[model samples]
Target: MRQDTEGLLVRLESDKDGILSIDRYGFIQGINPVMAAMLGYGASELEDKPVRLLLPDMDEDLQGDEWRAFFDSRIERHHDHLLEFVSAEGSLIRLDVQMFTGDGLQGGMTLLCRDMTLHLGAQESVFRQREQLSAIYTHATDAILLVDRRGYIENSNPVASELLGLSHRRDGPFFIDDVLRIKNHHDAWVYPFSQALIQERPVVVTDDIQLVLPGRSAIPVSVTASPVRDRSNRITGCVIVLRTTSESRRVSTRLSWHESHDPLTQLANRRQIENEIFRAIDHAHIDDTTHIFLYIDLHNFSVINETCGHGAGDELLRQLGRMLQEEMVNQDVVARIGNDEFAILLWDRQPEAVMDEAERILQRITAFSIPWRNRRLKVGASIGVELINADSTSEIDVLLSAGAACAAAKAAGRNKINYPSPERDSPSRASLSQWTVRISEALDENRFVVYCQPIVPVKAQRDTQHYEVLVRMVDPAGNIISPGKFIPVAETSGLIDDIDRWVFERLFTTLEALPSEVRTGYSFSVNLSGGTISDEKFRDYVVNRFAGSSLEPGLIQFEITETAAVSHFESALAFINALKAYGCAFSLDDFGSGQSSFNYLKQLPVDYLKIDGSFVRRMEVGEVEYSMVSTINHLAHIMGLATIAECVENQSQMALLEEIGVDYVQGFLISTPVPLNTLF
Candidate 1:
C-alpha cells in the first residue's frame, strides 16, 4: 500500500494541476506532491499543517470560513474560489481552487489547486509598465491627452491639466470636452480632431487657434492628433498633443518687422520699398491695375543745415516722417531712401489719384513748421511722380527716372510737383558730361595750366612778397576753366589729389623758370586741399621735390585753409614745424571762416594770417568788419606774425585795409589774378 501511494504521489507531482485535502477545522489533512512542491515544501511536512499557514493573510480568514461552510452544506459539490497563498519562503502566490465534499468521509474537503503564478507575474509586470508610462507622460513638455472615440477625455497627464488650466481635484475622471471646452476655445482645431477620429487616421491642425485662459488671456496653440489602436487593429481612441506657438509667432512677426523696417523712424527702408514696388508691379501684371512711384525731396535742406544747424535739420526730418505717416494710407509704403528724400509706392491707384495725393502730401509738408533753437523754421518738399507700365522691367531705371524728375522739379522752383516729360527726359546738362570728359582727357594729356596771384605788401615794409598759385584747365578749344568750376567737379570725382600734384609740379617748374633777380626777392605761396594734407606720401613727395633747389624753402610758403588746418591739426603741426625748420614759412588762409579762436591761433606755428574774403569785402564801409580786421591785425602783431587782407576789389577797400594795419593786400584792385608771366 505504501509503494502504491508513493507511485500516486509521483504521478501527481508530474501533473500540471495541483491537489490538496483539508479537514473541516481548516487544517491540512493531506496534500498532493504537486501542491507541496509548488509551495516549496515536502508532502509529509505539509500534511496535517493548517491550510491557513500556507495562505496569505488577505485570503486566509475569509476563504477558510467559506470553504468550511461549503463543506458543511454537503450539497455544494464543487465550488471555485480565487485564493491568494504565501509560500514557505514568504513569496505571494495566486491560485484558482476548486473544493469537493466527500460522500462517506467526515470533516473532509478536497481542494484542486492550480498554480496560476506565471499568469499573476505577467499581470503584475503589465501594471508596473503602466505606472512607468504614466510617470513619463505626466512630465512630458508637450501636453498629451487620451481622448475616447466620442471626443471625451478618457485619461490625461499632468501636463494636459496645466496646459488647459484645469483643477486637479480627485473627485471624478475629467473629460477633454468639458474641461478644455475645445469647441468654444479652438473651433478651428476641432474639425481636424473629429476627422482623425472618424477616418481613423492621423491629422495635423495649424490654424490661428485661440485658447481663452482663466484670465481671458488668449493663448494660440497648434494641435496634432493621431488615432490609437489596440492589438486587434480596432480604434481605441485618439492621442492629441498641443504646442503653444504664440511666443514663436510673436518672434516671427518681430523678425519680419526688423528685416523690412528702419529702426530710427519705424518706417519702410529702401529694401522694403523695393520689395513693395516689385510686388505692386507683380499685382498689376496679374490684373489691370496701375502703380506709381513718387520720389519726394526736401529743397534747400543743405542751406538749412548750414544756416541753422544740423540739430534743426534733424528735428525737421523727424517732423516730416511723422507728417507722412499721419497723412498716407495704411496700404501705402512710405520710405526714407536718401539723406533728404523719401519714396512712396501707390498700388492699384489711378495716375490722377496718385498726382492728387502727391500734391496733398507736398502741401502738408510745406505747411509743417519746425521749432528751431529759438524760432520757428518753415520748409517745403518737391515731389516727382512716375507711372509704371505693365511692360516696365528695370526697377533701377524707374527709380533713376523718378530721381531725374525730382531734380527737374527742384530746378524749376521750390514746392513744385513735377511729372516726367519727354523733353526733360533727355539729359539736362550737356556741359556736365562734356566737362567730365574734358577734365579726364586733360589730366591724361597734361593740359592743366597754373596761374599765380600776387599777395603784395601794402607799403614798403618788406622787400619780398608771396604769390598764391592757382590752377586752370585749358581745354582743346583753348578756353581756360577757372578753379571755382573745375575744382569742385574734381573734388566730387575724387580726382582732386591728382590735380593737386600736377599743380605742385607746375609751380616748381615755374619757379625754376623765373629769372634770378625775380626769384631772389620773391616767395610763392601754394594752396593745398585738406585731402592732400592728410596724405603722408604727398607731404614727403613735396619735401623731396624741393630738396635740392637753389631757392630757399622760405621762398615757397605753403598756404592752407583754417578749416583744413583744424581738421588735420596733429599731422599739419608736425609737417609745418618740420618744413619751417627747413626755412619754409606757413600761412593760414580763410582764417575767419571757421570756428578758430585765439586759443587755436596761438597753437598754430605760422608766419602770416590771411583774413577771409568775406570780412575784407566789407572792411571799407562796415565798421564792424573794419573792427574785425583791426582785431585780427592786432592779434597777429602780438603773435609776431604778418597779416594779408584778401578780396580787396577796389582802391577804397585797399586803402581801408591798409588803414586797418594789414601787412599785405591781395585782390584784383591791386592787380587781377593774372598768369605768372604777368608778375614777371
Candidate 2:
C-alpha cells in the first residue's frame, strides 16, 4: 500500500502540468518539474525560493504577509486567484492559481496553477471587437437609438442626444410612447408602444416634436423610427433617428416669397397682384365687394438710376417702399415688381378711393429726398387705377391690362394718376386664345417681318447712316403688331431665339438688296435680348447671318441692353469677344439703365453708349437733369465713346442735348421709326 501511494505521488508530480507545495511561512517547499519549467527555472533553483520572487515587485507584498495572514485564518477554505508573474527571462505570464489546505500525510497547503495566457488573449480579442463596434455606433452621423419592445429607450448615441436635446444614460428600460408623446384622437388617452412598432420596417412620422432645453427655447425636431430585431427574428426593440429642419422651413418661407413676392423688394410682386385681384373677384362674386388694382410706376426712377448711381436708385426704391407701406391701407398688399415700378392691391375700394391713395403715395415719394454723398436727389411716380368687378373671370388678364394703362399714363406725363378706360378692360378670352393661336401659326408659317429704325448721327457729317433693325408680326387684319404686345409672350414661350434668328436673316437679306450708296457708310444695329446673350447657338446664328452678306462687320453693331450684358458677364464677355474677332462692333444699349453700369462698361467692349430715353426726356429746365446730361456727355467723350440720345421729342430738348455734346439723337422729333424702303 505504501509503494502504491508513492507511485501515485510521483505520477502526479511528473504529470507535465503545474503543482506546488507551500509551508506555513508562505515559502515554496516543493515544485514539480513542469511548474519550474513554466516559470523558466529548474526544480532545484525553485524548490525553496519564496513565491514572492516569481511575482512583480508591486504584487510581492500582496502575495507575501497578507496572504500568510489569510491562510492562517482560513486554512480549509479553497480560493481561486488570478496572478501575474515575471519569468526568469523577464517575460510576463498570467496564471490562475487555486490554494487549499490538505490534512493527510503531508499536512500542508497545496497550490494548483493553470497557464491562462491563451484564455485571457481570447477574452481580450472579444473586448477589442466590442470596443470597435461601439466606436462605429457613437461616431455615426445618422441619429440612432435603441428602444425595447415597449418603446423605452435602452441605448442611444451622441447624435440622438444632439437631435433630441436630451441627456441619455443607461438606466431601466423605457417605452417609445413616453418619448414621442403621441396621443389618441380624442386627446384623452396615450397610444401604446406596440401600436407604433414594426420589427425591421421603417416608419416615418413628421409631427412637431417639442424638445425642452436647459433654460432655453424649445426646439422642433423631425423624427423617424424603425424597429430592430433579434437573432430569432422576433421584434426586440426599435431605433429612432431625428433631424432638425429649421433651415429647411426658412427656405420654404422664401419659396413662398418667390411665388408671391418680388425677388428684389421682398414685397408682393406681380403674381401677388394677380392673386389679390382674383381674391377680390371671388369676394365680389359672393359678397358683392369691389376691389382696385393700382399700378404705381416711379416716373423719373430711370433718370435717377441713370444719372445718379444705382445705389441712389435703390435708396429711392426703398424709400418708395416705405412710403407706400405708410400711405396704403393696412390690408393693402404693396409691392415693387419691376425695376422702377410698384403696385397696390386694394380691397373693398372704388376707383376714386384708389386714385386718392395713389395721389397721397405720389406726393409722399416726391416730397421725400435722400441725401446721397453731397446731393439731395428727388424723383416722381405715375399711377394708374383700375376698378374691377368682383365677379371678373380673368383676374390676371385684367391686372395686366391695368398695368398697361398705367404705362400709358406714364408715357403721357409724370405725376399724373390715370384711371383705366373702357379700352383697358380685359380682352375677350376668345380673342386672346385666337391671338395665341394666330401667333403660333404665324411663327410656323414664317409670316414675321423685319423693320429697320435708323440710328442716325445727330451731328451728321454724312447724309447716310446706320439703322437698327426691329421685328414686327403681321396679324390676320394685315395690321402690324408691335413688339411690346407679342415679344414678352414669345419670350415666355421659348420662341424668342427663333424670332431673333428670323430678324437677323431678314436684315441680312435686306442689306444685301440695298444699293451700295444706301448700304455704304450705313451701319445697322440689332437689339439682342437677354435670352440671346447667354445662348451660344443664337450667337452662332447671328455670326452666320453676316457670313456671306455685303455688310461690313464693323458697321453691323449688335446692341445689347446693359441689364442683359451684366446678367451673365462671363458668357457675355466670351460671346462679345468672339464676335469682335469677326469685325462686329458692339454697343451697350440703355447704358445707364442697370445698377452696375460703370462696372459693366469697363468689362464690355462696345462702340456706343445709347443714353436711356428717361434722361433725355427729363433734360428740361431742371438743373438736376442738365447736370446729368452734361456729366454723361463728358464721361462718354473721355471714354472715347459716341453717345445716342433716345426719345428726343422736341427741338428744345434736342437743342439742349446737342449742346450737352450728345453725338446722335433718335425719336419722333428727329424722325419717326420708318420702314426700310422709306429712307431711299
lDDT of every model, 2 decimals: 0.71, 0.67
Candidate 1 deviation (Cα RMSD): 35.1
**Top TM-score: which candidate number?**
2
Residue-wise C-alpha lDDT for candidate 1, range 1-680, written one tens digit per residue: 01222233444554777778777667788777788888888889987777768754423445534656533343243243556567788776667765555543365666667888788679879977985785477445566788887777776654565456442244435665555534334354355567787777998766667555666666677778899999999988889887667666445534555566565455677777877777776777778577888889786564566568777877677667777887765366688876577888776678667668778788888878765543457777878777766754445445656765776787677899888556655543224444555678999999888788888888876777668888888878888878777775565344677888888887788778777777788778888776787788988888777675766657777888897676556557777876786788889998887765576678889989999999989877788888888888888999999999888898888878767778898988877776866666
TM-score of each: 0.41, 0.44
* Candidate 2: segments with Cα more than 4 A from true spot: 1-254, 306-308, 390-393, 422-447, 451-468, 474-524, 528-552, 559-582, 585-680
Looking at candidate 2, the ten consecutive residues that score lowest on lDDT are 1-10
What is candidate 2's lDDT per residue for 1-680, written digit by digit as tens?
A: 01222333544644655777777556788888778888888888877767667765334556434655544433233244665667888777767765555444254455666788788889879977985787577555555677877666777665564444343222334455545453223433333235446325666645545444455555455556766778987788776765555766334433544566554454667767766677767777888776777777665565566567678887767666766777765356787766667777776775556667667767887787765653567877777776767546566555555565675686677687777655555454214334555667888877788777666666767554767778889886778889887776565333666777677777777777777766777777888777677788877776676665556656667888886677556557777888887788777788666665575577687778888888888879678767877787788888898888888899899889878878888887866666765655
Query: Pairs clashing in candidate 2?
Result: 151-175, 151-176, 152-174, 152-175, 152-176
Clashes of 1: 1
